[model samples]
Target: MEDRLVMDGLPAFGLEVGAFSSVDLVTAYFGRIADVSNLNAVTDPLHGIPILIKNNIASIENNNTAGSLALLGARTPRDAFVASRLRAAGAVILGKTGLSQWANFRSSNSSNGWSAHGGQVFGAYVQNQDPSGSSSGSGVSAALGLAAACLGTETDGSILSPAQRNGVVGIKPSVGLTSRDLVIPISEHQDTIGPMASDVKSAAYVLQAVAGQDPNDNYTSAIPNSIPTLPDYVAACNPDALSGARIGVPSNVLELFLDFDNSRQVEVTSFLSALSTIRRAGAEVVENTNFTELAAWANSSAETIVLRADFVTNLASYLSKLSFNPNNITSLADVSRFTKTVQPGPEEFPSRNTATWDAALDAQSGFGNTDPRFFPFLQENLFLGGEGGLLGALDRHDLDAIILPTSFAPGFAAIVGAPAVTVPLGFYPAGTPTVMNRRGNLVDTAEGVPYGISFLGRRFEEAKLIGFAFAFEQLTKVRGTVKPFVVPKTEIRRGV
Candidate 1:
């Protein structure tokens, strides 16, 4: 199956850049099924399943480039904590998938799927449409059946956005639930590895395998006792799980798109249709709920300040740990210099320059732990995004979870270190006009795009989110497995 997908030129879509030998993969597949009884209970759900680890996640057998030219050909010294767990659970490590260069942190105008090392990744449904960032290849590969499931790391919307755009299920677990050790970093405050799969069950299976405490990451040491004793998530995928579930619908999110004319109407109608489905499933939908304080914090300079500072600090820390640092690149400044020397200029690698890195360095220059402004920034971001924000809204509404268009709520969950699960809502019709005429002129002939709805839960409330997502998935059956792209013989001959 893996060979067939590779032969179809799925690599051109940037789904996979490198993989283990077929012999090693087969041996591991058989070895896992044979060893499962001792390592796991009789119900080792992921036994013999093949999964792809995102390139940024360390894997000893595959290159861990994080989709950057600067780290090309780099090899991991050990498996990432998640990767080790996947192996222990009897899953085959298929390979490393491509990603947005530096997880889409290199430039403001950079394309979502474009990587300096792997080129652009196209969407599963439409060849030319964007495959939303960072986790672009992971989402595409899962949707197209290239792998049983794929691991994707998210900071903000990296996992859910691509899953939404590609019509797949993505679960961004709470920060401490998944270890970030051995993965490339953007910000430790928000970064987490999660699963992208064709269905909620598969995502849940992957999550069960990869999630747990890790000695290397101090954050995991404090995991709530509730998480450790939780039941198997695969057993929690009840079709009637939404019955009596209280969900809040944030009106501010809808208002953000209310002025887009027909597109806005279509999206709103779709959202309302989803609400109808939820009601029919016996869930109470609380309408017009607003995250008033969250909106203010999201719009403020606090997020930018913290992210910029953390990116420089966290990335520098990760770089220093790399066992195969051939370039002797020890800091963000070294990375900037390497990019300038190797890639040269914007004219040659138009969207892959180091402008964002330079800007982050400048902003973070005088920042330190002892600085009064530094700790306050972190404290305020957590306070405003957590207790005073999402948790407050949930308590105010007496809600079990919040549902919004996938695009709107990921940032909220990310900032608060909460969990979110995105499932396919529906797809816009082909040729549906997505853009409005600013001069009051209507435009036609736009490509269809997939949209998803997200379930946002309190910190460490992954079980609730998964149950809701599974129930909604079973109710709608909106997700479809995509066919692999067939490379034309002529193009194949032309070496494309």
Candidate 2:
């Protein structure tokens, strides 16, 4: 009667994100002893394969948090598009992973990975540390090998930060390539779901199985199924990808980190050295680019204004369509109210309200402080004037892609909606040599931490990005996996 589908080191089959291994996971993996006739077909699609989902996607008829307590006991009527694909691919629908409450758009001060239902997902390296949000649990689970891979959604950095903090591969697909009919929303313009895996190939495999045009999502109509269907990802891992490829180094992002964290210099040292490998690989590296104008443009008030408009407008439509009772609240207002209850179950709201309220207050203050010049600066300096911003930079330099660090530092913190990818460069040991800042100041590492160099491209260029990442990974293979609940033991690899 023991189900062959059951396996150790697999994720739970129920709904809670990053819920510890449980009887349910065991049952899902191995069919029930009494159900022999059905047991033959009960093989976990994800049998030996383990993966986690962001709490937003509904699978296994379990609770869908969307990182909000309002839907505490709510059961989504059906499996999300990606969840169905994961199941079909023979991947175990591991439990849902934690995320920033409401994908971190609900509040400004809302920590990146905290949710009333899941609390905070911890970093794989340091247990008492930040597992960068929205997709925090997915990144953590992938890094620790609690599962073979995991899924994470992003409006922005949610996928990237966790990947950076957990030291793994995180890819944010083109917005329209993947369907979003059942997943929670952030911004239709930017919201997307992608894979968080131990390496680039695994992430590509998940994407291959799940990506396609959906009848439900209108935005997807514009993207061709052939584009997402391309399988060159694994084949594109040419160690020679760097050769003949033009890479632009944004001096602006480096300067921004220089101002924020002195330790960033230590992280960049390995990154710069990694760039040398690109040169050794025969790529041309261009430095001393002035992208300051573009950097400031991205963080301006105009962007926030755009986000707010979409948040209110899109959310209203989504809530109006949902069919639910009073207990199953749907709107932001209802969620805010439900977050205040002191209940015993995961839906208990008192603690969550604190994070939500603080986020709201911070958002208001952040908006007020944003400068108006930032918008025109973007139009004139980056997009129009052609200094940088993916497309502009790529065309101006006649390049394949641009490279930059995924984060200012290797450590994690709270933030919402930023999608990023971290590939191996080389390790920056605890006492490694450091780099000089814009002001020509030198610095050293206080501790050993992993750092990565990133390649950026125009929107919808994930295939290129993945191809480049595959090449880089094949060359370096720096990513590592940890045995769950155990302390890390190896020196982190770089640029893999």
Candidate 3:
């Protein structure tokens, strides 16, 4: 759509024409599948719908730049598994959405939605609202109905946080449920891609198209062999699945939110109400399901050690696969130099340094998972997500899912590679104070800025979590209530 909007047979048009009037020029229409996909049209749920992928996901037609200037013209060998799956499901490739530069892995204290290539992306709900990200652009795209839905990659909070902030549904799949081939890397162990859509069922529909094995991504081979085929995720949108379901709430995890963000406690006002709603829907809301070792895990440097070690190696692997590399960047050290030494100041060095890259390069251990100390650090995380965290809470409480404020929920599952879904919870009140983040430009709180509740569970349990999210979504229909300040109406009519 970016290409379509900027280029055509015409000369000067957008200068005078309103965005709504240039509708025909904006849409990137493609041929609808007949026998192209192996499945029937009836079975291809996303057939004919236009879907957007994040800028990082490699597509042959688009540059897989990860919003960095260095890779601006670089091409990919083929579509990412996410993109290929969308094509296989008879969906149209709408285009790419912006992301945090290097999926928010580039620098410390960087703004959530700013990318050197994509510019600063803000939420539509309020004036300069912080569109929580790496996946910020995708979340905002869905929030504004730019397409049916948009796909976003998550190594952690990228998908979930932005979805809540944007008043939409975001599914952060358990790692390995979707292929990461050709997508930009942060940490291979945690990186996974999922859909951000207007609602739970819509997200499920999108997830159904892409959830499967791809030989290119060996991580996907981890899908249980016993399950010859994946479950019918769309059908799993059972509105009544919440009935007689046992859901747990971790007070300890919730307590840590105060340290994470000042407004974290206030933001969960509706989350407290969501518990009552869950109870009325016939789900038992088990309280005080504590992650006793959460404090210890949070205080430890285990997660950082894992991410830094993984990143230094994983990033090089991604760079090695580029079909065309304009800058001859084959390593993080090369990328760092390009960002620092490049004449035009495109990388914003003084403001946003390559400190993260520097740290990764300086990692005491050898390349990532191969490091001898890697397993011990990984085990520390496993303990947090497993016996000490989300997994442990589930088994200890005999729970179907764990519910928490979306802002506070992603970490436990992230460390352990478990699935989590966030649905619209509530918005800040009309008189809420405007708050700015460390970046000094991005707003953290304001009137009508959205928040969400999350349902997290074991790996490969996305179907069950989606069911619960669907029930909650149907009950609330809260997405409709909160409207953006400048509502975008993407009515594709005839060209002028």
Candidate 4:
């Protein structure tokens, strides 16, 4: 396989400068392993496009590392439901991309996109800065055009944050819109996989190919029958789609970390810029939408106790059933101890291991019905009742959709089982707001990094979101490329 990839031409995005450091490595790998001759479609039909699947995802022929050494050499007996869908659609499975260890589930202060097996993945547009975590490599590879599209899973900020950093379009589908079977688990309740691509159209195409029913994932049952079919995602991109759409600018999401993360300012500035762009594109922009009235709900605890319990028990059971050896390490406690004693490879990227430690110590919270932290009512309704709440606003205003900064603000924060998406609005100015200090001071950082506003709407409203994004993209037409690298074109990889 390595020999067949030796004569590769440079990737369209030029990611092969110093070493096989980016998606070029993925493209090269696919050319070696797959019989890609029958595939067709690049960014449009998505049939034959080369796709970089995150390491956490299962590909029968590849290792499912989840960016951790713990799963080293563990081969999946079959493809993940999503991976199978891609193959059936004629897509080539490009090699896996590097990611934060355990999708940044290990610690709190961990760096983004640093994996033990693949090292650190840089934001292609700005090589020096962090590529926001968990699914960071998938985002970077897509941005560099290593493949026409890539698959990224999100449990919170993983997908969206990296997409913003890498200058690409990412969609973290509704909780159950995509299947979770065969993908390494964080929290079954919130885990989902979606497409990350160079543009919204490409992302939409990939999403269509992968979003559908699966016996392995019962969640797909919740998908509505009224929505247009997956292949029709491009229809959402009406140039006038935003013409009369009412966009809600939630002031509270903007203030979520105001006291601790000053990066909010840089993001706020960018959000304002995006709002202006939306208005110029002819949308009805409503600034200062409030979600604070539901603060109790928005800030409600995630009931991680339930999540942890499920993880340990379920994981142990799953491992036991596997044909592979069940190490003396069966619980999170054992895994934590193992990680502490072993030094990962130099290319390894680390996420905050402290969080994993915290989760492990508190695993008992999930053990029995005795723990008060186990299961609690989903108290807040940010997605439910307020003017800024997703459903409420959409119903009240008869809006076509709404847009936000894609996140509270970006920095390095990891949470398991949450989902979201990020899109590129083009480059942000120097000294963009970033890192926060204990003193509550905001530090300006990550100059030359890309910043994008996020579009979120009612659950299952992906079509609207994608359409709106496509409309914005068509208006701006700001395609980005990675900083040039000096290397042989023959060493780079192309699409599947």
Error of 3 at 167 (Å): 0.3
Candidate whose lDDT is highest: 3
Best by TM-score: 3
Could you tell me the lDDT of residue 304 within candidate 2?
47
lDDT of 4: 0.61
lDDT of 3 by residue, 204-264 (tens): 8889988898888888888873224798888999989899999999987777777676676
lDDT value for model 3: 0.80
- RMSD of candidates 1 onward, in order: 8.8, 9.5, 8.2, 7.7
> After aligning candidate 3 to the native by TM-score, how far in Å is the CA of 18 from where it should be?
28
Candidate 4's residue-wise lDDT over 1-496, tens digit each? 3322332122323443443434455544344323221111111111234677888888777777776666676665688889998888766676677777777776666567666666656555543456677787787666555566789888667788778767778888876778887887776655688888878777877788788878878878777752245436767767777887888775666676565566556667767777887998888998665554445544545434444544655455444433443345555666666676666534222323456556546634335323454444222222323332555555666666656665562211112122334667656565554543222221114556676777766666778778788888777765543341211233343333
| For model 4, the run of ten residues with the poorest summed lDDT | 37-46
Q: How accurate locally, in lDDT, is each candidate?
A: 0.72, 0.57, 0.80, 0.61
Candidate 2 lDDT over 193-307, as tens digits, reads: 8888777777777777677677877776756445446545556555666667777776766777777776667567767777777777777888854453555454544444434
Alpha-carbon TM-score of each model against the true structure: 0.83, 0.75, 0.89, 0.78
Candidate 4: where is the Cα deviation over 4 Å? 1-49, 226-231, 256-259, 297-299, 303-310, 317-321, 326-329, 342-352, 363-373, 377-388, 409-421, 431-444, 481-496
Which residue segments of model 1 deviate by more than 4 Å?
A: 1-49, 226-228, 257-265, 343-351, 363-371, 434-446, 481-496
